[model samples]
Target: MRVGPVGVLVRPRAGVAGLVVAVALLGVAGVAVFSGSLDIAPARVLAALAGDGTRVETLVVVDRRLARTLAAVLVGFALGCAGALTQSITRNPIASPDILGVTTGAGFFAVLLITHPALLPGGSAMLAAAAITGGLVTTGGILALSWRAGFDGLRLILVGISVNAIGMAGVSWLLLRTDIDQAAVAMRWLTGSLSGARMPDVLLLAPFVLAAGLACAYLARDLAALRLGRSVAPALGTAPGRTEALALLVAVVLASGATAVAGPVAFAAFVAPQAAMRLFGTAGPPPLAGGLTGALLILAADLTAQRLPAELPVGVVTAVVGAPFLLYLLHRHRRRTSV
Candidate 1:
């Protein structure tokens, strides 16, 4: 079945408006690079981009800088798409991998490998695989808990918050017990830097992301069915449990793959789909749209981060950027429900 979008019959211009978002993001990126935040001139940026530039520009701008930017975009897209799928499956507006402790779980495990030389394999690939395992296990735990209580949305969120607290404590314990050098390294990863993303890590993430994305796309119809509640969905030829599991699997893979590539970049998942849902009206989350929006968000944020005097980690910038939006969402939801 060729699953398409859920049409809520919004303004005729709404689709066009989505296209404009990409253009606006590009403008912001260009301004960031041109405003002397980065030493590379536009021509140099263009030249390095085109595979012909000075050695210095090629090394610093193209290899170091642009690679990190691209990593952010790819990771952000994965997280955003996964977030959309999870929210749809659970019918929860605040459902996100970060909030559910999945991302933090991955980070915790990966940090262990980075900290302890005696712990298993220590390569990026091994760390990534471990992270994926951690995320899957964390998600499985949440699902199990949610299932026990008949999968209530409010119950699931409460469980997720509790899990997040536990995961945070685990991360802190790792920080406190590890040696200083290892702690420093793990801390950078935790803060989520796009500082040194190489071609190999990017290549590793590509296939998993593509496969997970396609899986989410294929499940979109069943996802829409799920919003009607578990009992109602069965009458529509949908197996709610199975569909939710599949969506959760896709989300877990996406979240893990993204964390591996870019560490646990904050709020990419929560912010992307929420923004897309707002833009598209009262439709199911648009996987494609969410992915694009995520890419745009990360790209813009990374560009800004690079240009900033302090050059904060892209993830840090995203956290600062997304927190206010999250607060607004919380306030709005509270107000509407109270009314």
Candidate 2:
């Protein structure tokens, strides 16, 4: 299907694939919520979801597992959409919130507040604000450094690497200054976990996620125009600068909200869009498919981590899975560029 002046090929099979992924995600989420250490049956889980389970089932499924599961889905969706937008804006398959220092920046600011609550008022709102601020500042710095005549993806990635190094150093310094217990807590949070994920945190972030999603939907046509190149974008009546800025804003909001709730989440942002593209056989980012892919990955990973001999952090599991995929992607990109 054509969009704007750019003829975007929307594969007929992509929608079917996305629907399949969504259904798979629900199945995985069910297993994740029901088949944990407590081992609630699927029937009970369903009943609890429908608000008709016994007290014990309700406590296990609705009270505890449901909140964590919902948090995962929301955060995963946010990260996935953020990743797609960032990659599209940069015209780089590998450009992700985590790779571009956005997640690192958010993590740094949130860690700072955690390590020293006296630095600011102690609340989730404060933490979320710090995350969003850090992400915007870091992204702005990357853009400033990368823009010579225009934004260059290679330069942006390199600058992001430098910024990420600095952010990690800052986090390390904070860890050093804090007590052992506090440092451990901070480290666990940095690795990402859905444990103790409360519904209130999810509720607080829902509005931001909804708003960003709506904004992204509205800007889809402009994004299609922008993909055709800066020269072509203006001819197509899309103000490249404004469109890019608004897209970046949406990405930042989504990433910051996810980070505020779920820490950095390792490579969820990076893997999601790439997986969607592969699944859909599309050149451009498939936002809906990407979000579903991300939610599925997170739920599966979280479930795997839970079922292991020793439960591991969800981030650790993702890193183990994603790092290899990242290497493969880099090799493929290198080969393509060389060719």
Candidate 3:
């Protein structure tokens, strides 16, 4: 597609790159399934996948590790899509689930509720619902705080930063006060590990991700219209107010559902869309490409975290990757302003 000043054909090149990324992601998933801190041969991995492996290998590869890998992919896709939606609606490059305080808020409630295991409902279903609620509530609060007769991107970012700081502080307090077992659970949630994900997490997140993804696709045309600015978009029949609200709601669902599954994964949301935009050389956030970018990043990061001797948290790994990218973005912004 010819987007903006660039008359680039997105079809031929983007398709091949996307396929390559997909294949690479599948290979990573296979690696996660077949290998752990200890490596497994490909033949044995295939046997384990085919259900012909020894009991120990089956339980180790197919049962535990694959589940975690799948969770990482799905969670990454959800958060990446959420980041795209938020950026499109806000017309801000830095908007993300973490920056908007949505994930932190969901994480706060999740940590609190999970602390009292008995207080949580019997399954991941209930946990997912509670987490989604937390995300929505926080997003709603940020929206309200940022609303001063009109939405301003700078104000929104500020409010989000403050809200996130407060939520994280609350999480820290909960962690410090809780018992060792509960604290351990809280720690995983904080660091964002997919270690013990079951099918329940997948089932809970998949439907929301699919639905919201479709919703984003439907709004893509409208979102493009909004790029013309406040006056032009409304004149063109894109109700700026309603569109912004819808976009925010969709973003909230995506972020919340993902957070429900894997805790608040850091940087995937921010970095994925940015990476996708650069890859595609597109003006607007590329939802499909962004999701794929996120899936690749998270899968690679999760695998690295698992393979590391220390077993570092996946979120930490993402932060390590994203911090430099963030600095680059700031540098670019400064250069642009100077020019």
Among all candidates shown, the one with the greatest lDDT:
2
Q: How close is every model to the real structure, measured as TM-score?
A: 0.88, 0.92, 0.90
The count of backbone overlaps in candidate 1 is 0
Tens-place lDDT digits, model 3, residues 112-136: 7888767776767777787889999
For each candidate in the order shown, give its overall lDDT on alpha carbons: 0.79, 0.84, 0.83
For model 2, residues 256-296, the per-residue Cα lDDT tens digits are: 88888888899999998898889877667756567778888
TM-score of 2: 0.92
Q: Which should have the higher lDDT, number 1 or number 3?
A: 3
List the candidate 1 regions with Cα displacement exceeding 4 Å.
Answer: 1-14, 25-38, 41-44
Instruction: Itemize residue pairs with steric clashes in candidate 1.
Output: none
CA lDDT for candidate 1: 0.79
- Per-prediction CA RMSD (Å): 3.2, 3.0, 3.6
Write one digit per residue (lDDT tens) for candidate 1, span 1-339.
Answer: 123764444455556757777787667656544444446777878887788988977776666665665676678778888888877876776888898888988887788778776788457888889899989988778767866745666677788888888988998999899889989888888877777687667777788878877786678777778878788989999998788778888888888888877788898899988888787664666666677788788878777676688877788888998898899999999999999
Alpha-carbon runs more than 4 Å astray in model 3: 1-13, 37-44, 51-55
Model 3: residue 109 alpha-carbon error in angstroms: 0.6
Superposed Cα deviation of residue 182, candidate 2 (Å): 0.7
What's the candidate order when arranged by decreasing TM-score? Answer: 2, 3, 1
- Which ten contiguous residues of candidate 1 have the minimum total lDDT? 1-10
